[model samples]
Target: MNKKLLAGLISALLAHAAHAFDPFQIKDIRVEGIQRTEAGTVFSYLPVKVGDTMNDEKAAAAIKALFATGFFKDVRLEIDGQILVVVLEERPAIASLEFTGLKAFKPEDLKKSLRDVGLAESRIFDRAVVERAEQELKRQYLAQGHYAVQVTTTITPLERNRVGVNFSVNEGDIAKIKQINIIGAGAMSEADLLDLMVLRTSGWLTWYTKNDQYSKQKLSGDLETLRSHYLDRGYLEFNIDSTQVSISPDKQDIYITINLTEGERYTVSSVKLAGQMLLPEEELTKLVQVVPGEVFSREKMADTTKAISERLGNEGYAFANVNAAPELNKEKRQVAFTVFIDPGRRVYVRRINVSGNTRSRDEVIRREMRQVEGAWYDGEKINKSRTRVDRLGYFDEVTVETPAVAGATDQVDMEVKVKEKPTGNIMLGAGFSSAEKFTLSGSVQQQNLFGSGKHIGVQVSTSKSNQVYSLSHTDPYFTVDGVSQGFDIYTRKTDTSTLAVGSFGSDSAGGGVRWGLPIAEDDYLNVGLSIDRTTLKTDANSPLRYRNYVTTFGARSNTLLTTLGWQKDARDSLLVTTKGSLRRAVLEVSLPGSTATYVRATYQHQHFFPLDRRLTLAVNGEVGVASSYGNKDLPFFKNFYAGGIGSVRGFDSGSLGPRDTALNEAIGGDKRLIGNAELLFPVPGMGRDNSMRLSVFMDAGNVWGYDSKFSLGSLRYSGGVALAWNSPMGPLKFSYANPFNKKAEDKVQRLQFQMGSVF
Candidate 1:
């Protein structure tokens, strides 16, 4: 006779077996009722082995072990003539997975999500796991504001003990915020308060911004902004009590309500400093920004503490602590603040370790460091070191951390990590016009040549009107004391016969040596010298002034050029600057011995101001003036031109100046003026991505002949919107402009674009 025991009946049946049967040794073990799983897999999980005494306890343990594996839905143990039988009813394996009516998410993305949850093809299927996967998919849709989404699962049995799983999803309309209410905003208007938030009710630009969509995370951030607004305006006891979000029955609209209390505004009664004043009392007192008569501002208080701490850090107190304790007078509606300073132990850097530089040499980064090893830790020096390294353009990211050495209270080690980017690039540029037909230019440059922090470039351009080839090399650190030197060799050929300018041709060859000396942390003094020989070619179509100049100076002329320049750059980034100012002034003078002696001075100033977290206001202006010296005439070809991409938009390139009346073409002038104001912001739907930006700008400028006086009324004006993208290929820029003043003789190009170039 065969005896059997089920897993569920283990406790009850084991009692019967213990009383009626005696213990017997197992002769052999066998597994049954498993089609896909190997029998050896089942045998390995069994607690009992052949030739072991099998009792009621061992039988119950074996059945429980097999059931816990999740591969089987039912398990049983049987005995027949001293042999043990282990039977398992294996769960169905998933054969095929499919999805239908899915629009919001890609099929592969959903499959990957299922795989992450351990519910994929070829895995044993359980109803509970499938239900979890279904709920997960619904949650994902809800996060995207698809509140009305529907998901249905269908399981169909297939051959060979397998099953097919299909998830049919219908993503409905996205829910949008319909209204927002503030309960206790007494001091501020509702409109004004709402403007400070990123999320809002539906509006014209909501489709692109997606601000109308409700998100738990976005709501939380908005709440914080609301709290800060009142706190910054001297509402010392401001608080948000509660928030409520509700949706319509159709799930297509959402409403939000916030209740807050704005307490009485307080003024600063007095401010004082206490505890361990390391610096001069008067000097530290000047850093306090909170005035007794002014309203108490959290922003100013925070600024005061940070400034004091940084100042102390510069004095080797790397871990200095500064805190502001405010005493409130509710009766008088005033507050008094005492800033407490704690100067920690003086610390020196024990070691500096560099990492993440896979290609650049250690010295390439080390030389840029302003903080030296074994020196007292100076916060200012460390900040400068990080900024200098980041400005190298060899790395995408640079980070520095100073952690206290193990078991050492006054010692720390600095870790400088860098993420290197591609330093070599091959850039190609092309331009098209009616006169030139087509022009192509290319450059091959390595900014960090051989990991030595040097730059080398080969540039070539070809066209019907102009051709240029140049080679340049620069060593940023020619001398250890931060002096830079560079060499350039170039030849240029220009033919203006097919262009808007006066018809003429010229061939020139020259080379230059330049040097840069660091005068300050952000200032540089530049000096350069060059010699060039130019041969002029003129025909009947050339302007009278041009032909006369060529005849007076002969067909060929030689000149010695000297340039002196001063530059101060405080921009936070070279690629995408949000704040800071850059000023550059250069003077070029030709010696009296040259065929043409002239002095040209040009100055440019660019400043950026951050309007908010994601917006910047940039103002730029440039001026250039040239005059003859030693009774020599200024070179005709060296005249400045305006109305171009780098000057004024909505006009032809280099087409603005005094016109050649005979040829009805422009003749460039000896003076130039350009000004631009741009409001820069991130592209909509791109959250905090620095790789791309959009700007609305106003441009104004003009060029004047030597005899003409500078007049504000003569300047051109334009308004436009531009897009800048730092794509994988290169930096790309596009602009569309409308000229406010377009003369009949002026040539206008409303649309302009460039690649592999900076704007």
Candidate 2:
């Protein structure tokens, strides 16, 4: 009874207090309902202090200021006796974020996109904002042709009032372009109209650039290009009337319809040149591809303008401008163009700046540069520098920019930037055929030795028939004028089949020096000389020297080499190369310090054609004829032989052309001819260009007898398939071959593999 009476009394006193207390009259203030906010922060924004009066208006102002901080969900104020209290409910902070079922983009990429829109992993998460972000993500997916994408978001509360969010997504199929229609196009065929567009269905190169994949961004760019193409072609009133993109019933195919208004086709009646006459007027006129009385083609006009500008540039007018103005003759349905020229101050290169070569030495690039500091600027030289840098194969990207020097009207600075790529290579290889069981070879090479643009390498090879060790070095710019100098030291032991004997083993050591001088940009003249001593040893099983004759003989020889060759490289890369060369050498073989002479002449031709973007067809033919006219005789090692992976596949190593009864191998003849053809194509589904390739090849070659005649019937034919791979360890290759014209007793060669081979 007493508790009830007290409760009644308290209620009565609270009612009385509510009516009597004045918020404006409170002199002190405090805070309440704050879970994470500091009391001092709330008090700092309040109007009432320890000795000041407080009212509902001042409390409302404090509420607004505190709310402006964006930290609270709810705020209120109240007064009790002589004190005012502020209240706040803090918002939850984000703890974590996760995504699922996302295939079109990497997780980190999507996270970055979200962070760009103020949605990160560890910040406050709002329900309304999250819904907006989901809508945006859906729109992005749809733009990329994932029309059936689904996205769901969930939020879970964690300790300390934090919330964790997860976005589950399902990215569906990418919509394909079924058809593209151009409507209401005048003066252009439908096929031609479509040819001006970029978006298309997937084709052979689709896996390379992915340009055929449908995307809103790419479509928008294509539309812009169409608009510009028309506008620049004198279609002043052209417009895109309407564009509609529709999806098939299955939603897998898309059709685009574009309606255009091609206003009119204008003709050029007269063309006048106003550019600075750095050259004769007649010479400059020859550079203009735009002629009067021809239909105005924007592409041709642009080419003409660029040609004019480049002509001036070649004459040291580096900053020349040629603007073409179109004068319309409406009555005559014709237009006249006047090319105005503004040649800015002529400039010279004050300095050539090289950068991004943290490893390559400075002299390497400087030696290749055709341009020099303090010389008149030449656009051709600059372009050549870019090409030279690209050909080095050590850089992924190379760019040259000319930055003008302030306050120096006649001087400019050239900056070259390069991105380095890997250049070192190692090779492990093996091969086998019917004659030789197995051959093992390996090599380690650095094309750009210490980034000095020199090549140094060592190779070792061993087989049942041959063993070799070689070291070589090449200085590409030996004479500072782009001459090339090379040196090679090698030693080898090999078993050979001789004409009179069956098989024999020989050991030899030799070294040679060679030099190449550029006769023209794409032509070179090479000369080399070598001297070696060889010792031949015969075994008891030999056919000729079994019992009655000495088994060993020694010979020393000096040789002279000369060659004149021309090369043309318009191919996109060395992998698809075409080359030809002719060489003549005079060799002398005798006892050490004796005089002997022999001469040989050889010629070769090769061609490569790209059957399609993915395949290349290559053909090569070579012929060599030699005569031993002087007192000296030709060295047996200098003879020509065919029938191996490097020659005619399908047969044993050194087992083609002619046979030596004792050595049981082919000893080459004096005159030889060989020809080969191959078709190389790429395989699918590999990540990079270094994928495996397939090849079909044919080879035919033979050697003539010393006193017999050469006949086409003697040519041996072989066909086979090969596997090629541009491996990081070098070009790995393998092949299996069968001779088309084999006897019943002859066995086909086994499968063979090789590495670090040029062919």
Candidate 3:
């Protein structure tokens, strides 16, 4: 035989002989069939060595060790005289991985998951791993309601003991819910019960909302919703027996059946207080929300308990626990409740530690914290702090954990962890409205300036009607007492022609210094002083209204402006809110240094109510009046204008009030009144998406000259569909309206849209 062939033959034959042969002193050891793996790796796992006696037990140990490493497909040990030979068939290394026809998930996402399962590129290939990966991929597709999804994995051998793993995926259509049947619902209509749930059968809006899609989590939530629906309607013993979700064999449809038992409806007979009522019983009883002779409501019971606990907490009972115990009178179908209060020790905060702020300064988060170290641990304050931080828009998530400190009985530490979010934005966007054909706008804003709680922004906007440039900076904590200082410099020019006003324009340049003092937890008082020069320019085509205004107020006027404003924002969220009220009032006075002397005051109030988890009702109103302070005519340029998305959507922006003769253009007016009502709801397909919302709104308001009488009958009425989306490019809005009631001269702007801030 050839020497090289003989050596190979000898190694293979002896590799298996050692396991069956008697004991022998091993003089040398040789390994075979290694392609890319280091030889030392194999030797490290091998039990037998050069000086060891190669017996059946040792050979068995060597085989076990090699196979356990998962780097080899097969191994054999043999002994040639005193020399041990190891024969190995290495597992194929994954030289590459590819996916074909994958759409439901990104290729990188699948690869990342594969890496976690030890099945990525350059990893040893195992049959079990391949099967597991296939199953895992199938599971992921199923979770997305793609029951018909098919995943097939193929291992193709390659050169150098490597293999290419290819995953071929056919992501099928999402399984849609065909029907939902709620069984054993008594004392309630099916429509009423179903209305309380988010899941529904396929409907016209399913393509956008996707509430018709099958989701295990959605079903779970729906079941809970059903329970609450019955419980809140006086079904004291509401019980959800079972929920069955079935998918079609071909996987295009899903059917859900929820079994529930709505017990006898009960009414509230009485509410009594029990168990350690530290305060007067009358005070505690006043906190009860459940009304006698009204339907028994679990929601009211929970609210009553929460109110009692919160009341006790306000009195320094930080660890208070309140419970509601119900006593049922079966014959009368009435329930009586007793509230029990447990006021635990008054605990003070030991420490307020903050973490997870890698970029934001510690002070930035601490300033928003309402709870302080060494202060009483008030639950309301802690929760307020969490919400305050969330409202800053500087963090994606904020969490507060109150864990009791060790070696202390009445103290706990507040651990506030915040996941910071990007506060820098570069906005370059455009939008269109019927009034303003196409407007372009851009801005560079940094809300968290240099990890400090400051806002700095520069915005420039240009359109057919208006052009503006503004720069502003605000330090939220300019003073230790939470005073905010800011300044703005801006130049603006507005052409009235595009707005159907006069063929005239006005140019203004100015800057202002402002300071705001935090008067209350959610209130601020602002004072500002500004200087501006207004140059009113007119062509020969200028309307009589504009020419008369310039003749009275002077074409070129310099004014010293003073502003006083107050705001109380108790809204839970700056965007997409359901509760609370926001009230703002501002008064601006053009002082004696200029040709124009006027005082303008505007007050706006907005309130929101959550009709349900998915629906909210909002009402907003604004009233404004401006007049000359010292018997001077109000500046026409500073007049308040109504109409548009913020006023009345159906009318062209600023085109609803007093019109100039001959030009037939709205020149604005000194008095304005606006009111809006909106029913906000979630858009289809976007589940629990707070970033986008759709609303049906009614807008009623108009601008009136100080001489014109303000009457409700004169207000134009319009109802429209509006959308607000906090999209990646910035905030976007769209509206379509029909002026159900309109004057013949009112500018009709039926369609409007905006991207980013138009002002």
Candidate 4:
């Protein structure tokens, strides 16, 4: 018999069994029709057991108990010679699940969603549950603006009462916003009001931001932005009355309308403080942003309150309350501001709890903390601690939360959670150029080794002209207080015999130890010492200057090197920085050596200014000089070279400077000067994305030999456009330049591109 019909018959028989059932004692219980489920489960759920009197009430109660288990599709009871019989039809279990045409989301994510709803693989399937899953998938699509999405399900029965469930989804086109209407704009123009919202009708740049897509969350955020816009412009009583969204018949187009009221613009009549001031009243009053006869701004008011609160927080009162409420007058269109202050008891941090560091050691994150345990809580320090952890680059996400202790009202616990990412990078890349054919390079770097916050890197490079191998390690905190120490050992060979740079080769092996001390926030002082063994090889086509130098100084030399440097970086961001300045100065010198004794000093400064939201102007300047301290001459290999990405683009790398005496080949120089300016702009399809940017830059620079004089005629000039992207593959750069003022002898590389991870 079919399970449904058999179950219905049993229910009917139970209803009629009351009239026919005589009081009788049940002897035994037997369950049937359970394939995978144990019979003991049915007996446990049964309210009546052996030796119990059989009656209509008991039979009905037993049936109700079994059905509630959700393990059975049907339950039946029968009496055969006083031996109770229980028959169960268990629901089919889901053997496997599959999805087709699910483009909006990944398969694993969808499976997880199904698992959350208890309709996944290895779980019993129910018709009602399947319908619910379908609705969920449809709603997910609609939230992303795919209103016409269609979802259908299919179940294929298998042996052993198992079934394969499949969900087929058709994620149709995203509904485009066709129209947006703003009504009830009094104090502000309708155009000005509409400009404040992110949502818009289909426009040229809609593909990037998708602002035309209809979403509930987007609408809510846009409405909030609109409210802030009016409130910041002195509209004290701005209110959004209603919002209506309509969809077309085909569901491929949507329309949004918002009605809002913008009250009269109010000017500030007076500003006063109404509460106790822990600090001087005059000092706190200065933080108040409003002044008499000025237009009232809620943004400024909130900022004033936040500033007051933070000042108290910095002073160890973490729980301070600062409020700035306004009194509005309609008749005069004037607003009165009152600042209230309540300094709560000083709180201390009980403990800082670090969690979610599955692979990272606790100390790796704790070292970044500035807030001290068992000390008075300072809000500034706590916030700084979070920023420091986030800047570590080991974690994909970092979060810090402060929650009050259960029993300690004066103490709070801070929880720091971090999600670790793949910190080790191994890169193998090859590039081909007309000058250096088939160049290959690779490196292995671990910034967070075993979660100890130490750095280790190994690098190797080979090309037709240059070869390098190096190993290095760094401890960011050799001792506390932000001191760093590191060491590097390297062997390099470079043959500058390529077309424009003269014919010479050098092999050098060296080792160095460096120490860095933090002088201030974002400023560091570095000192280092090194010893190098260098041998020069010259060819028949070598520059005349190099040949003379080899003859005079011999072919091999041992030199002692010392370096002192200071650098300060205050950029707002490492990538696509729009503001801030960077300054660096370095002095590297060779102490009296068998082959060389010279001093080289270089200074560089870079600054950027934001012209507006869409543009920034950056300028860079550098100057360097190298000269022998005594009778020794500056090493030929130590001469400063220019005409490259860092100096002058559009010219060949290391191909500009004073020429050889006879061959006219670039022999580099002992003096260097360069200046660069760039106008940064947003990429075409990338709006407000800081990971990538485009810039138009101009570069003018040159290197001068020790005997050569500094002159404007020797400077190389180039102007072009460049693109920089922090892509998934790696950091990529592409630039096109034109050297308009180049001399006939200058080697120009007009188009340049670099790819692959170079770390």
Top candidate when judged by TM-score against the true structure: 3
Worst 10 residues of 3 by lDDT: 1-10
Q: Which stretches of candidate 2 lie above 4 Å from their native place?
A: 1-94, 112-144, 182-199, 202-212, 216-243, 258-272, 289-303, 323-341, 422-572, 576-759
Off by over 4 Å in 1: 1-66, 77-85, 394-396, 420-500, 503-517, 526-538, 552-564, 573-578, 589-599, 609-618, 627-632, 644-657, 675-759
Q: In candidate 3, how many Å is residue 246 off?
A: 2.8
lDDT of 1 by residue, 1-759 (tens): 867544556667656634324568999987889899998888888888998998878877887898889899889887777888787789999998899998889989998998887899999999999999999899989999999999999999999889999999999999999998999999999887787677888876578668889999999998988887787789999999999999999999999999999999999999999999889989999999889989988988999999999899888899999999999999999999999999889899999899999999999899989888999998999999998899899999999999999999988898999999999989878765434557788999999998899999999998899999999999999999989999999999999877667788999999999999999999999999999889999989898889899888787989899999999999888789999999999999998799889999999999999987689999999999999988777888989888757889888777888888887778899999999999999876454565789999999999999799889999999999999988766677788899999788888988887765321
The TM-score of predicted model 2 comes to 0.65
lDDT of 4 at 428: 88
**C-alpha RMSD of each candidate structure in angstroms:** 4.7, 9.0, 4.2, 4.2
Q: Over all chains combined, what TM-score does candidate 4 have?
A: 0.87
**In model 3, which residue pairs have backbone atoms overlapping below 3 Å?**
14-78, 15-77, 15-78, 208-684, 208-685, 209-684, 209-685, 210-685, 500-665
Question: What value of lDDT does candidate 4 attain over all alpha carbons?
Answer: 0.84
- What TM-score does each of the candidates earn? 0.83, 0.65, 0.90, 0.87
Error of 2 at 247 (Å): 2.5
Residue-level lDDT tens digits of model 3 in 126-200: 889888888888988888888999888888989998999999999989998988888997688787667666788
Q: Which residue pairs clash in candidate 2?
A: 23-54, 24-54, 501-662, 502-661, 502-662, 502-663, 503-662, 503-663
Could you say which candidate leads in lDDT?
1
lDDT of 4 by residue, 338-452 (tens): 7888888878899999998888789878988999999888888999899989988999999988888898878888899888899999988776554565778999999998888
